[model samples]
Target: MTRTDELIALEDKYGAHNYHPLPVVLEKGDGVFVWDVEGKKYYDFLSAYSAVNQGHCHPHLVETMTKQAQKLTLTSRAFYNAELGKFDKFMSEYFAFDKVLPMNSGAEAVETALKLCRKWGHEVKGVNPAAGKIIVCDQNFHGRTTTIISFSSDPDAKDGYGPYTPGFEVIPYNDLAALKNALKDEEVIGFMVEPIQGEAGVMVPDADYIPKAAQMCKDANVLFIADEVQTGIARTGSLLAVCGNCSCENKCERQESYTRPDILILGKALSGGMYPVSAVLADDDIMLTIRPGQHGSTFGGNPVAAQVAIAALEVVSDENLAQNARKLGEMFRSEMQRIIDSSDLVTKVRGKGLLNAIVINDTPDSKTAWNICVKLAENGLLAKPTHGNIIRFAPPLVMTEEQLMDCVSIIEKTLSEF
Candidate 1:
């Protein structure tokens, strides 16, 4: 009878049941909040998996998209578009990279990085041609592609998705010794990992792990690639988590603490959750190895994507979302810690910036996180469980202190009820 009911019915009738989305069907959003078709308001804690770092329907990004759409949307890679060059220049300058290769999704950027690394191994590093091996972290969440999933430790991601691709060696995350052991093989070309495993439930490694791992890779002539699709763009209160200080030099010491990736992969927030625009950034040698016809996407670097991305990056800088995320994230984590200390149901709360998670001691079959999320939905906050017993709470960076406190209160109230 209602619009929400009609939408659900239509989805059940026509859509494939791939994702188990929450019951609420959001019809509109602004900044940190979204409204459902039923006209109920809820704070969006997930931010579409850290894509809306600039917040939902950011005016700048929307304006850019609208203006660009009116002028031009697509012009295949065969011919250069006006916006693409400007966007590439802006991105290179913003990230301090020599060059960038654009793609459509986080997974595509990741795939591009993999290809680039392998090609660089053969062409520049002079490793055995076609024998390059990339060392990946165990419990990694790169993407859903066959090659990405082939190295996945999660059974659900890889099940029935064989025959798998090879040339990947899985090593335990944050363990410098294991990474050293994996790279001892002459065929090893690079170490690919998420600075913080986002989909693995906001898993942050040891403070010194990434820097040490990067040093080891550098010593072994292997590239250190950071897949920062979820952790980058101020999601972790840094422009790139590996970069430490995403927007300024005040945190130079902190920036130096983490290992900077040789090849940087970014997506999601790159377009401010407006459109899918991912990219691979590298210095000349690693990025240039891929010649024409090696790899590309038709919609990868379109005019619309270019304009949207430029606006998105601008919003991240102009709004100071990183600093906001840092301050609010600390407040959130502290509040959650207080709750965790008091509650017996929650085992721990862990994460950086707005990207956070709480572990439920209950069994997976209990769907504790799911039940909590349903309660959270009823309380006007939205979040989703990553795994069985872990719930990820990552709100957009544009949230105010009052909004964050309100969200914290909602969470506290919900947890108390549980």
Candidate 2:
């Protein structure tokens, strides 16, 4: 067997069968590209699910991690570390949140945010402890944790995860009326949503949906929680997906379209894919509800992760990744539309910024999208399918215009094969 086949066999023999990954086994990665074990190069269209927004193995993040690693790594929450305070101050000013609850992964941040919401509900909102409910949208892809999967519409993630956590209400995404009606419940303490549903095939809501929803939540005293784990850090052409059409390069100051969330959950690109780092941010009134001993992670605010995250956020701003994503996204969609105009295989292309997707003209159960992805891999590009029929195409935001057009050409050629 070949090296790729041997590696695949080893994984099949030892690893858990939870993930159905694409066959390619990558070994090396740089900005917008990866090479497999055999050294065949391909454009990295997935960007580790938008975790490597600063591009793979970024020098700044590597330097920060390495420098911090030489000094210290983890001190846990038991004792305060030097980098943690700096991270707290930097992130607070970076995202404009009064406080931050650090965690190791995106799921942990979501859980932390949920716990914070529940705590705020009971302590501040005066809701009965067991009676409070947070509203979540249908087809949301928050995470795979049992509590998060409880309200999931996807059968694969939800089924068999029995005795699921309760206290969450399901509402249709982007439906203002449903949100308005749901807010009428006095027990409703928060509305948790993704500014752009990334995993559900890059679903973008109406232009007015987010701002209007925030206003409604404000009117009803409900906390507007934005889970920007997948869509944040310049993925959706903004510092945060909730920034709306505003294209500011740094921490947003709430422009006309900016829908500021009361509670913000961030992850993925926080460390530029060098280390695990996630954070939940909120103002003093909401975040202070959770005392010191209530919640924390051992490696949440570690020195390496802290410094890496600072470097990563700096990369986003310094490199103008958000602005790059915004400009390139428009270019990409227009190119995809040009292809779709004459093609029969691709029916639609939709998304904002670099986080985009193309719908294969086939049933969700069909293997068309998967086959296309395999072909895309063969043709020197890599992308993955979501919900079977939709193929998500999110590349690193550091890609230049020439590189993007080259990728577009590769995509056009690949689609023609179908």
Candidate 3:
């Protein structure tokens, strides 16, 4: 057989069946395109679920990661490393928080944020320690950790995850009334949500949903925790989706329209797809509750992660990624609307920034979206289905108008075939 077939067989033989990946085997990636093992080039429309926002193998991130790796890599949290302190200060100030808790991955950061909220709830909110409950919205995709999946509404991700951890209340997403009703519980700790439900087919809530929910949280003495793992770091046309309507160069000052969070969870592009890095940020009042020995990760703030993160963040502003996302997102949506209005295959296009999706006019359980994705892969663009019939179309923020238009052409061509 061919090399592609060989590689696929090896994976099928050795790897677990946890993921149902597309058939193409990518070997190299640049700004907006990736080459498969067979030397065919394709646009990477998914951007590794927004992890490679700065683009694959970004020179700056690669250089920083390489230089740091040559000097030092890991120095467990026991002994303070040189890079960690600088990273901490930079992250706290950059994100407009008093302190930051570094972690390894997005899931770890979510768990860290949950732990922080619970601890703060017990200590500051005066909630009974054992009864502390965090409010999570349905259709949220935090991660695969046991605690993270405990309250998941997705049967594929949540089923048989054992007697799931308790203390989590599920509410409908983007529903301020549901949030208001839930916050009335004395046992509630915080309301955690994603500004845009990326994994849930890039679901953008109502224009005022976040700002209103944040205010409700504040009025009820509840902490508004934002899980920006998927939607943060310039992914949603803004520095953070919560930083609504304000495209500030420095993401510190809060706009009246912005929905500032008490606890901000960030990851993915934080390391520019170079290293696994994530962080949870909060003010001193709430952050200080997690005293030493309460929680820690071995590879959380290693030298390489610190350096890579700093460099990655630098690229977001220096390269004007957020503004680019905003401009291109509008263009993308407008083009998509034109396609939708003319065709019956796609029902709608919805999203903010480069993070967007097209709803297929087929049953959720049908393979139409997956089949379209396969055709997209064959037509020199690669995208994937998030849910059953909703295909996410997030490309790297680094893409230019020319490249985006080319991708749109390819998408149009492929859909016409379908």
Candidate 1 stretches with Cα past 4 Å from truth are 245-255
Per-model TM-score versus the true fold: 0.97, 0.99, 0.99
Give Cα-based local distance difference scores for all models. Answer: 0.89, 0.93, 0.92
Estimate, for each residue in 361-387, the C-alpha lDDT of model 1 and write its tens digit: 898667888999999999999999987
Q: Candidate 2's residue-wise lDDT over 185-220, tens digit each? A: 999999999999999999999999999999999999
Q: Which ten residues in a row have the lowest lDDT in candidate 3?
A: 248-257
| Ten residues in sequence with the least summed lDDT for candidate 1 | 245-254
Q: List the residue pairs that clash in candidate 3.
A: none
lDDT of 1 at 119: 94
Over 4 Å off, model 3 = 252-254
lDDT score for candidate 3 against the true structure = 0.92
- Clash counts per candidate, in order, are 2, 0, 0
Error of 3 at 278 (Å): 0.3
